[model samples]
Structure formats: C-alpha cells, structure tokens
Target: MKVSMGVHQLKMEGPYLTALRESNDIREDAAALQARMEEDGYIFIRGFHDRNQVQQARSEILNQLHQSGRLAPDADPEAGLVGPDNKSAFLGGTNTDKPAFLELVNSPRVMNFFTNYLGGAAATYDYKWLRAIATGGSTDAHYDIVYMGRGTPNLYTLWTPVGDTPIEMGTLAILLGSHRWEHVRSTYGQMDVDRDRTEGSFSRDPLELIEKYGGRWATSDFEAGDAIFFGMFTMHSSTVNVTNRIRISCDTRYQLASEPVDGRWIGKKPRAHETALEAPLKTMAEAKKEWGLA
Candidate 1:
C-alpha cells in the first residue's frame, strides 16, 4: 500500500513503511507490555479509552470551532467540516484548561494504565498538546526529547485521536526501531528545541531519514479511543490531512510521580518554550549542519 507522508509518497509494505503492530493483547500484563515497548519503541492499543467519552470530547471541540467560524455553517458541528478560513488550531496552553478537554486527558482509565505501566503512581504534564489540523496540515519528523527532555528520561507520550482517523486525515506515525538508533540519539536527541532556537523537526521529508538511516515508518487507521504510547526518544511524525474535515488529537506526557518532572510542562501555568519565540529560529538544515547530521 502506498501512502502520503509529508510531501513524499511511501510504500507501506516495503522497507519504507508498514502498519503498526497492535499491543492490546498484552495491555493488562505490565511485564509483557514493557518488554514489547522496549523492543519496538512503542505500543499501539485498540480501544484504550472509552469511546463515548472520546466522542463527547470531540463534539465539544468541534462546537468550539464552529462557534469561532472555523467550521462550515451548513455542516453539523460533529462533522468538523472546515470553513473558508481553513486555519489550523493548537490548543496547547491555556486553551487546554476547558472542562471536557481536562476530563479526556485525566480520565481514570488513562491514569490507571500509566500508573501500572510505570510501576507506581504516575503523573501527567499539565500542558497538553491538543491540535485541530486543517487540510494540508501535518507535523514533521522529530524526537520528543528535543522538545521536553529537561528532566526524567523515562517520560512517555500518549497520543489519542479525538475521532475516527483514516490515513487521509493525517494520523501519527512512528519510525519503527528508531529509539535504538544510538548515533542519532546522542547527536540530534541531545539538542533542545527551546535552548537551541532551532526549527525543532529533524526533517519535513520523511524519505530523507529512511534513506539516510534504516527503519520502517508505521501507522494505522485510528478510531476514537485508540491510543499509542512511546518513550522520549521515539522518532515520529504525521501524514498530511488530505480531507476537508479537521483532524483532532492530543499528546500528553506521563512519567512516574517519583521522577523529576520537566518544569516546562508542569504547574498551574507552564512556561513552555516562550523564550525560544523571541529569537530568530535556525532552519533544520543549519542546525543539522552544526550537529554534523548533514
């Protein structure tokens, strides 16, 4: 199967890309789950959350978009049809404080899973990365550590699709086994998105990494309540949104409560990468050249 990722067309069955392996079978067994994560760099769970709750959260977000004139007036709010404005929205900061959004992220199901997975009490970052991606919008390839590696190396990211997300709608994709690429980790992962004042993404072209290094890109059609969890070093990105409807999803971080938290993502008001915006950013090409990755 051929799919679009960023600006490139990729063959899903060949050496380039493939479907993600689902780990729902071992979800209840922490030891098995941990072993799978350690080997594959991620775990994809089917129906990891309550479907109704996820749909409700999606409805609330769509209604907000409709009220702001971002959704087509003729369409039902739940449809999430983009209006003429067609602007993408990132609700990572204060906007995440909305009641429905908070409930979706802090649901007992997600909390309990993390607590068991981490082998103790688990706490999530207060700052959530909620996005409403419009047509043509997509994220580039990058490691989570570059953006949030200030403290615990054990921190993990849980990505939840707010609704049914087919390939055309642009969903998250992981570069299989990329977490074990020690060379890339020591060089690119060591750099900070905020401190380095760089573009953040390693590459807009997914094929670039595949050609340089060697790993299959894995993704799947995700339904509401489906979730994927990966550690800080996992390399991942999203496919392009080819559809008219918005692609809604959220990225939340988790770690053991006893571990030191990244100060940028916690507290009543997180000072998340605010200082980086003040300076002129360096292009990935420039940054990669400095890191000897080019």
Candidate 2:
C-alpha cells in the first residue's frame, strides 16, 4: 500500500520553507526558526561542518574505541565497529580529549539549530544510548520519548551521520508530516502496548497506513556533517544495514523547557476509540450513549 498526500498537504510553508532560503540564517532568528520547524515535522541543517572536520572527528571516535579494547574481534579493524552494546558505543570518549562524538554534539552549529526549536530554557544534550549496530541491526517504528522519561515531549531528535549514508546504506526515513499530536494520542490510545515498549521491540501493526491516503515519505542522502532533525512524535524507522560498510551517526534528543509529565508513549491503549468502535458489541441503548450513533 502507498500512503499518498495531496499537493497542499505536502507543500512546505512557514519557517520550514523560509529556512531553506539561501538569504536567511536560521540561527539569527530563533522564533521564526522554531515556528517553521514546528510547522513541519523536520528541518535539515546544511553544512554544519567541513568535510575535513568531520573526518577528524570520525578518526578520533574510531581511535578511542580501539585503545579501550572495546572493538569486537570480528569487527573490521579499520572501520572501528561499535558493537550492539550500548555501553561500548559511549566509550568513544575514553580515548581522545574531544572525540568526534563529543564534538558533533557540542558543535555551535548544532546548538544554534536546536536552540531555535527547543528554546533557551529547554534541556539539551546527548545520551549514552547511541550505540553501533551490527550488520542487520534495525529499529521498529516508535517515538524517542519512550526511552527518556515521559514529559510533554516538546523535544526533537537530531541524527548526524558521520559517514556517507546512501539510500542503500541505510539512512533514516520518516513519515514526514506525521507529527500530529491529535493523531499521535489517538493512535497510541488504540494500541495495547503502553510506555513499557522497548526500543528494540516496539512496533505498531498498522504498517499499511503509512502508504494509505495521501501521505508523504522522504529520505535523505546524508553527508558527514548534515543533520536530520525530527520531532519525537514523528513515526520513523530504518532499513537494516546491509552494506559491508559500518554506519556511524549520533542521535540527540531535544525538548521544551517545561515538558509536561505524562508517562504515555507512542503506543498506549486506545480506550476512547476502542470504546466507540466496540459499540456494535453493546445493546442499541448503550451504544447510543457510547458512540452517539443512535
């Protein structure tokens, strides 16, 4: 099934369209920037680092992993494989004074883009869960907030690819404008799974909806420094890393300064919708009150 989008729905508007203009420097105006980003599910920040700078950072992360002896024996010696272990993935900082991983997260270019979206008071930083995937490692469709404690998920995630992410190389893909809060809450409410879903095992069975109606799907070929910014509610997943090469990237989360306290995840019991849908199982009188379908 193919999820299709009408012309207007796929059209870019507000800050998202303006930010892409060559004359505008998004970092200069935080308000307009955030407005645009929020209008769309994502914004791509171009040229955060020079090719050489990215190479240097990549080198440092690889070297650090080697010195720590965390490199898997079966892993390619030159590629600096990050094992499936989350702990070992973070060990990149152990070798160099400021490894590539640290630099990527701490770059002013990155901060400027996020500050506009998350605001000044919002919490911002990288976490240790950024691990390396084995040959076939892949993630199911889910929100990022599930890993972090629940609060109004005002945050967005920035995925920085350290190496070339060709289409076949397994780059990230998103449902594009699927960041609707109403739909999110409604969808989650329909799921039997709740906040307990884990990153490795979380998935929704409505895989067909992605291609239904007029929906838009997009993917990018990321260079070393290009970052893909996406909201937590954005339904996204990726293909398995089938290439012989190892993919290197960093995933960072951002949120509003005053996020609300809600333990619900992307997939929760859809009580409200279920109640309405199950009306057929009830008597006519009860169904009338339940769904107002009388």
* Model 1 lDDT tens row, 1-294: 568897788776867878999998999999999999999999999999899889888988998888888888998988899888899998887455367877887989899999999999999998899999999999999999988989899999999999999988998999987999888899889988778787778888888887888888999999988999999999999988989999999999999999998899888889999557766888889977877889
Structural similarity to truth (TM-score) of each candidate: 0.97, 0.62
Output the TM-score of candidate 2: 0.62
Best by lDDT: 1
lDDT per residue, candidate 2, 235-274, as tens digits? 6665445554556666766565566533232222312111
lDDT of 2 at 146: 42
Model 1 vs. true fold: TM: 0.97
Regions more than 4 Å wrong, model 2: 1-32, 64-98, 187-207, 211-214, 256-294
